[model samples]
Target: MRRSIGETVILRYWNEGFEVQLKCQVEYIDNRTQMVIVSKQAEVLNIEFRNIYETL
Candidate 1:
């Protein structure tokens, strides 16, 4: 599926050797780099496309 900025999504990624799920809003997407920037509350995160397990 195609995702855009300002969309809310659920992402599952490996963090500290653990699989964690984060619910955040999309801030930026770089298709060429396959990276996404999302914000959850006051925290901003950078995630890889491959690590995004789902969208909501």
Candidate 2:
């Protein structure tokens, strides 16, 4: 499914040697860059679609 702004999502990606899971609210999306901007509490994260293992 496609994600949209204001939606809450769980993102899973590999980091270090493990898979990390983060839950954040979607803030913005850049289709050209295939990037997603999301906020979790006080932190804003930039995520690339290619780095994502899955979205739940």
Report the number of the highest-lDDT candidate: 2
lDDT of 1 by residue, 1-56 (tens): 35457878777787667788887888988889998888999998888888766675
Candidate 2 per-residue lDDT, tens place, 1-56, comes to: 25458889888976666788999888988889998888999999988877788888
Clash count of each predicted structure: 0, 0
CA lDDT for candidate 2: 0.83
TM-scores for all predictions: 0.72, 0.78
Q: Which stretches of candidate 2 lie over 4 Å from their true place?
A: none
Error of 2 at 42 (Å): 1.2
lDDT of candidates 1 onward, in order:
0.79, 0.83
